[model samples]
Target chain A: MNRFDYIRPGSVAEAVAAASEPGAAYLAGGTNLLDLMKIGVAAPDKVIDITRLPGLDRIDWLEDASVRIGAMVRNAELARNTAFSAAFPAISEALLSGASPQLRNAATVGGNLMQETRCAYFQDPLSRCNRRAPGSGCDALEGHNRSHAVLGWTPSCIATHPSDFCVPLAALGAIVEIEGPDGSREIDLAALHELPGSESAGGIALKHGEMITALRLPAEATSFAGHSRYLKLRERTSFAFALVSAAAMLSMEQGTITEARIALGAVAARPWHATDAETFLKGKKAEAEVFAEAAGIALKEASPSGDNAFKITLATRVLTRALTLAAKGTPDRVPALPASVFMSSEGATANA
Target chain B: MTLSISLSVNGESLNVPLEDTRTTLLDLLREHIGLTGTKKGCDRGQCGACTVLLDGKRINACLTLAASVDGTDVTTIEGLAQGDTLHPVQAAFIEHDGFQCGYCTTGQIMSAVGLLSEGDAGADPERIREGMSGNICRCAAYPGITAAVLDAERRQSESEGTSV
Candidate 1:
């Protein structure tokens, strides 16, 4: 890691003030920032350690029935909270399915949202990556990019955001609270990550000194607690990033779906919320054919960016399986392996 | 710039002066404090060879900055055993032959201890396997590792007069 002056700010205001200067970076969970620094991708002259900041590690229940989670709340703690998990089961499942237990314990909510992409080209300083250095040309475009983005991608950048927690949050329309040099503001979680345009590179939308303070889920987000599931496809059974993943949440009346929310991950620069498919599923019977049709609609606009044309088909199957599992209702307990597809069918339906 | 920080490591409180703020907790323990029990397989967060307990939670030490953990309690593999008697998880690993090259043993043992305390995974072999996935044993000693975690869980539960 590059040598730098370390500043441990006692308050959010102080932290922002220190980070507002040039060559300053806010350090939350060092899992991503330290790695980037070690690889010479990010070399900040000043490191503002915000891990000790007060009033940022809480999970507050609001009077409006919404929940406000502090940015410093660890991923492991949020997933294990009984009340939080029961109300937002899919979110908890998504959190548990990400990274490893140790990473989850140290990683924070804000850090996860701000983590850089896992593109090999972006991590390798020798490779030409436009995201890392604008106008450098992307090596992943013609190189081995079997996992590159298929949606909302441009030739300038084709890296996909590798966050499982963001998939369910995007599906539920979560809101992010931000604090910066100017003031505090809020934005929809979907708007926090920008898509690569034809001219500009894609990345987090936060300004130079802005930082995420907390995340909020509206009261109605809990309505799908009865039927919500997050399913991920990976090469390994655990401790791996997703090849394709989906979060399916539905509110049913008797045997018909009243409301539906679906989001796909690892397929785009941002979480791909299938709003059209969600609209089509309303008032329809929760059946395999209906889910298959919805899955087709979800991938209608997805085209291969490289040698990963199979991702479109694989994404469709993963979404169909996720919707099928959601229709069966969430299991009483999160599967032992979390969101892995290998979870026994019998165990999934036993709670229904 | 040098930063003076105080840390409680393995039951001992020490005031260590850091010459560089870029030092990671893994290097602080291994190089500065002379605690070589923790290994560094991958300096990045991908591997769990540098696992340690920070305030009773298992975290990757390599990714954690030494200056950031100023007042925290850290328990490393060196702290697991009391005198000559090994920790339950350590003893079970030996009984079950839970390793081949034994390079990843410290991290696997530390992660298992953290998993047991979390109480999320009980005596189920599948849960144990999932919980310990962070620590990769390249020797493919997963079967024995899973058996060891299960045995340790059962033994601890039995001693506590609880049914697994």
Candidate 2:
């Protein structure tokens, strides 16, 4: 808290206009912005909060069998939605696995997708990160890089994109609807994020002052059997960041794999699309051996840090487990993970 | 610029001039509103030391800007007991020895109230646990916290049965 201006806009247009103001930022859930403000990492002269914007909080079930989630809809609402839980358990699980309860309640769908990378250097004002300030040397590369990116990393930065939703969305082929000062455009979710190597030196490619309106999901019929699975391996059982994660979507008929979609997290500068894994998996039969082979193909190019080298092994196990479980249509629930992960009672509770 | 924030807190309508200069609702409630029952530990949203009910929904007041809560309703830990009578959640916490240092007790109780208010959809212990993960207690009193919630649920069920 510094003395900054706050404007609660009544309409999306008004919110966008306010956001386009000089040095203005959009505030929806306030989880990410407020956290940044407290530490002086993000200092917007004015904030245009769109939480009160009308009609942007609805989860619309379309005639096409797709769910269009308004940008302002809470993460918790989406996570607990019956349709989402049943049809997209992996996506729902990923949402449930992220952050904590209060955060999910306050975090909006758009906010979750667009949240910044959690590089310690980026969060701390004292340290330097190219993502935060281009040309400022990245302290994370030579420093505690255990949480840094192994793939798609550049000479400039190794910060991992810290969203639990985006990785699965990339696999499920989710689309983003945004309206900027220029006009509105619908882009595939993959278009929203840029790899570190190709990113512009001055700014991220998400564009300036564009307001996300809604997320459009592809119908199940469009992408056949074996929906998707968001598999995250964290240091702790819950309330911790993913060490190495994968979102797997297998397309199979009569024990023969027709297609596969695998995405990696925590180990990449962006949501790592394992097309190699998908390529290796296609034409293979549904079995533990084939899935393990695909995992190896996915991780063949992975390069890990000194401390995070173990994550390669753990990630392989995660990918294998996720593929096997997802093939059986029994993706593990994040809430009720096996008790072996909890070392103490402190690990066990929290829901409000 | 002074932002005029008005809210109904535990049935009483109160107004406060909150500038961005002030700390969040957790700070305003404890310092200005004199409702010290809500605590602020991590200042960040990571710790649930400042859990409160925002129009029946649970939120970390520390992350919530007080100036943004115009015309909204807020319920804090102090509002739980009506007069000398304790709400079942409050009583359950006390009976279960839900705290050692007790600094985070108010937040824990407030979180429990929030969970109960969430109704049947959030009645599952797993759901409740997922919801309340934001609040952290250093004393490792989660077992008591879980027991209090389950106890409160049991008492409510029993009372409902007896009346029926």
Candidate 3:
């Protein structure tokens, strides 16, 4: 880790002011930031500890029936909250599917949203990464690009966001509340992460000193609680990042899909929200064929950035499986393995 | 610049001065406080060898900054025993031979205690394995580790039942 000055701000305003400096970074859970620093990827001179900041660790049910999740709420806490989990099970599953129990206990929602990519090239300081160093050139393009992005990727960068929590949030249309030097504002979670463009390194859209305060899930988001699922394909059943993941939510009436939301992860720079597929699923019958078609529509535009053509097919299958599970109706509780594709919906050992 | 902070480690409170702000809780314990039980395996979040209870919640101490956890209670592997008596998880681990090299035992034990307190994973072996996935025993003591956690869970529940 780099030698730096630690500043614990007492309030959000104070934290914003302290982090507004050029070489300062806000510290929430420190799971990602600290690791990045250890690898010499991020070297902030000033560390603004915002863990002590007040009024940012709450889970509020607003009068409008929307739920506002404070950014500082730990991932494990939110995943275990009965009310929150019952209302938004996909989000809970996504949260539980990420990292490990120890990490989830310390990682905060805000920090999850702000986590950097897990690309080996990005983490290796010796490698040439345009995201790590602008215009330095991307070594991932020619190197082991098996895990590179297949959607919303450009020549500048092909690294995918490594956040499982944001996948369901993007599908559910969650709104992010931001606080910065210019005051507070809100944006869709889908818009929070920027896609790699010719002139962009492709990370978060937040300007300097801007911090995510809370995430709001609208009242309608809870409507799909009965038919929501997140499915992840990974090398292991636990303690692994997603190879290809999908969040599928549906509101069905008499075996017919009334509304649907789909988002794919690890295939794009951001959670690839399948708006076209979502539009195509409305009023369609809740069937495997329909789900397969919807999955096809979702990945229609996806192309292999490098040697990841298999990921395009894998991502399509993951989405189809997620939608199929969503149509089966969400289990009474989250599976023991959370979103692992190998686990049964009931989390039974017989299947394992 | 040096900073002063207070922490309650293993039921003992102490006011410690930190000369470096970048010191992690793992380093603070092993280097400053001289509690070497919490081994530093990966020195990153990837390995759970530095697992500790922060305010009764299990977290990777290597990823946790010492200054950020000021005024918080931390419990390490050294804190699990009651004088001569071992903690239920520790006892069960010994009974089941949950460790081969024993380097990851401290973290596995602490993580097990936290998992039991969380009450999410029950006596189910698969759930126990999933809950304890963070602690990587390179010796591949997973079967024994799972059995130990299951036995500990049963023992704790039985004790509670009899006490009640």
Score residue A227 of candidate 3 by CA lDDT.
96
lDDT of 3 by residue, A57-88 (tens): 99999999999999999999999999999999
Give the winner by DockQ: 3
lDDT per residue for candidate 1 within A1-352, as digits (tens), equals 6899999999999999999999999999888899999999999999998888999999999999999999999999999999999999999999999999999998999999998999999999999998999999999999999998888898999999999999999999999999999999999999999999997878999999999999999999999999999999988879999999999999999989999999999999898899999999999999999999999999999999999999999999999999999999999988988898888464442112
Candidate number that wins on lDDT, 1 or 2:
1
Return the top candidate by lDDT.
1
Alpha carbon lDDT at B3, candidate 3 = 93
Supply DockQ values for each candidate: 0.72, 0.55, 0.86
> Comparing candidate 1 with candidate 3, which one achieves the higher DockQ?
3
Q: Estimate each model's TM-score.
A: 0.98, 0.91, 0.98
Better of 2 and 3 by lDDT: 3
Runs in model 1 deviating more than 4 A are A344-352
Regions of candidate 3 where Cα sits further than 4 Å from its true position:
A345-352, B162-164
